[model samples]
Target chain A: MITREEINNIALLSKLFVAENEMESFRTDMEQMMQFAQCVADADTANINTDDTASSSPMRQDKIGTSLTVQEALANTDASCDGYFVVKKNG
Target chain B: MGRIEQIHSLLCKKDISCRELTEEYLNAIQRDNPELFAYVTVTAQEALTAADKIDRQIAQGGDIGMLSGVPMSIKDNISTRGIRTTCCSKMLADYTPVYDASVWSKLKNSGAVLLGKANMDEFAMGSTGENSCFGASSNPYNTALVSGGSSGGSAVSVSANLAVYSLGTDTGGSVRQPASFCGVVGLKPTYGAVSRYGLVAFASSLDQIGPMASTVEDVSLVFDSIAGGDVLDSTCNRDYKPDTYKTLKDDIKGRTVGIIRQFADNNSISPEVKSSMNEAVKTFEDLGAKVIMVDIPEILRSVPVYCVISCAEASSNLARFDGIRYGYRAQGDFMSIHQLICKSRSEGFGKEVKRRIMMGTNVLSSDKCSFYYDKARALRQALSNEFSRAFSQCDVIIAPTAPTPAFVKNRVVADPTVLYMEDMCTVCTNLASLPAVSLPCGYSAQGLPIGMQIIGDKFSESLILNMAYKFQQATDFMRTSDWGVKL
Candidate 1:
């Protein structure tokens, strides 16, 4: 069972700020979701295995086909420095 | 003739202008699309201009692409160059992609008239279309019932005769389940058969763009046009091309088909779906086809495996939407940028999506990583192995597409698992990366439609379509969805 504090903690982990009006609804919804997820938890996977390896196509040779120029790229975004998409500083 | 054949005939004879046909469909959208809520954004002017060009080409006796002048709707998750692709969520309601999805580009290149973007489950997460922020898409058959989703609008548009055919992305049973509920043919091609370059990521490994149409023959025609290799989509199988689907009209005599013993359960399926399957089996058997029954217990665990893997992948894939440079950003006096992302996502994503993201995060958490997620992965392997063994015994497998007809609206929303269970019948095919088609079967006692899913070996779409076409010929269920016939 999820306590009120646990709900708050999960919301913190999920980065969702539960609104005052929505808290009760969130709590109820989360409990129902957990029950649904429990169905997955009930499966017996004793002898099963997983393939977690990442696979992808071979890297292409360094040849430009089509690309956005700095002006074209920055034209759409509000933030621009030499026409590239301005992103936040990595924390 | 089918919709595609009619469009081709009109173009070939110069009997009608492509622009006229495009305008006719646009008029239909203007008249009916609002109450239907089938489209998210309708590209009237652009489509008309494109049709004009195709008409010009035809008038000049110049060769045009196979799908010239045919109007089709695309699921909202696919990026169109100038059109807004909201994925039926408030987060990206105004977001427009600078680049086009590979499929959109192909359709545009083929001169297919774009009707507009269709609605879907928010970020392609839910099985029912009700999860959409735009609005719950009502079934064209009965407004009280739901259009099965996240590709609900795509299936609904075709079912309602709003568009001849439409595109839908299937992750789990998004395409086929909706098609079943809408009483149409929804084909989820083998994972890599269609390119995913433009489709917004849900679960990358499981997502596939497929055709939703009124008939298997129309689906085959569209499938042949769209299935091919693409450099933009790394996961696109280099194998599938027009030629692969072109040779699929042969008889199924001497071909092997399998019916999983577990799928025959009366309790798991509605009587209507079971009877439809029985009729399809008899039709297949009478056509000189060999039918066999086998039990694959691994299918029972498919739901759990699918949930774990899909949620895990969804968590990772959705990480791109962090209220950063693009998408909805929530600003507050007390919060930092990180807190803003949290708040933004919390507010932007709906209840079901947030729940899955949390479940995925929990499974991927370092402490319980191996316990829940890892175990689920192992089951996925076993499921794949079971499919491999089943395929070794037979060339194809047949089962009910869904347990029953589309339920009344808001019935399953109170408990989301009921919605997820809709995917139970369609998820196994995705787990094994097999091609499957949901063909309209008989109708439920309540007069709602039922469908049977014909699953084929990986990349064996030809055989699957052939079988579905034969079965469709034997039954009249597909032609009975007279949503517009005015009873």
Candidate 2:
């Protein structure tokens, strides 16, 4: 079972803020998921070589061509400066 | 002839104008979408415009493609320029891409009419399609049951005949499970066989865009149009020859099929699904194919392995949705950009997405990295090797797509682990980077559809399609379903 402190630490690393009301349920759900994932720890992986070449697509030519226009790129942003994305500043 | 070919012939002979066909689908969406919730946005005007172009081409005696003016739905995760491509998540509720996904572009260039964007689980995270902020899409067969998701809406649209066919992405069993529940044909091509340039990433290594249709022939047509390489997606297979549609009618005599002994075990699968597997085996035997039982012990651990790898990759893939650039941003004052990002994510993502992201972060954390994440990768490799050995004995592996048919909605929501177990049979193919297709083999006692999965070796889409085509021909599961929406 995972502790609440560890869940908070995970939220901090993941940049997700769990609400006060949902924290307990969230913690419980995470613990259950972790318990389910514990099967990986028990699996026998001795001498198992990870196949790096199992599935791969060919690389394209390293050449620049058409790209997203500045306006098109910033079309969905909430705020933008002159050809740059804008965000809140730290106090 | 198949529905797609029939429609093509109708258009070629000037029997039915593209405008009429498009209008028929639009009318169906208008009539049925209110109850089904299969579509998030309807592109009625754009579809009519495209249909007009096809009619003009036909008037000039110019040749049109096989899918020209065919009405279809695209799962919302695949980007369409100027069309909202929300993964049914609030984070990207308003995020419309500046360009189209590779698959969308290919279908568009083929003159396929766009009906609308189908709703899906937020970030393709959930199994029952209930995780969508847009509200869960109901099964066409039974409104009380789930449309097995993350491609639930796509499956429903095809099942209900709102569109002739639709495109869906399968990470684990998103396409196959829903396709099974809805009694449609869903194909998940081998990894790298289709480009993933504009698909919103869930798990980079496991995601593949596939087609859902009422018939294997239509699925083949859609797959042929979309499969191949794209310079934008270096992971797409450039050498893949999607020539399955041409030889889809080939006989399956003298073929060897391996049935996983574990799937038929009464403890794991329901009686209905087990009987369906038996009927499917008998059908193969009747078709002059040899059937043998094969065992892969590693497959039993696929769900846990999938959870670790997919969640870990999802945590990294979804980290891009900060409040800064695009998507839904929380409204409040915050001390730092980090706080802003946290707040945005907290408010933007649904419960399932958050849970997966947090679990992913936990497994990938420094303390648990080697013990959990690395071990899962090694086990995945082992599972892949086991599948390779199994394929050496048989051309394809047969199993139940899910342990049972679609369960009642919200029954398994309280326990996320139970829902995760539903992917047990389907995720093994994703872990092995193999192609698999799910077609309606039989129906449950209560009239719900049951899916039989046919999994092939890597890049063996043609073989799998041929097998599914033969099975479909021998069965009436696709044609016998009476739940389709009448337009």
Q: Which has the greatest lDDT? A: 2
Clashing residue pairs in candidate 2, if any?
none
lDDT of 1 by residue, B26-55 (tens): 877787777768888888988888888898
What is the TM-score of chain A, computed separately for every candidate?
0.59, 0.85
- Cα lDDT of candidate 1 equals 0.80
How much is B193 displaced in model 1, in angstroms?
Answer: 1.5
Kindly report the docking quality category of candidate 1: acceptable
Question: All candidates' lDDT scores?
Answer: 0.80, 0.90
Error of 2 at B249 (Å): 1.4
Range of the 10 consecutive residues with the lowest summed lDDT in candidate 1 chain B: B478-487
For model 2, residues B1-487, the per-residue Cα lDDT tens digits are: 6678889998999998999989888988898888889999898888999999999999999999899988899999999998899999989988989999989999999999999999899999988988899899999888899999999999999999898999999999999999998899999999989999999999998999999999999999899889997878887877887899988989899999999976766377888898999999999999999999888888888999999999999999999999788988988888889988999999999988998989899999998998899999999888888888999899999999999999888784566888898898899999989999999999998989999999999999999999999999998897533444343
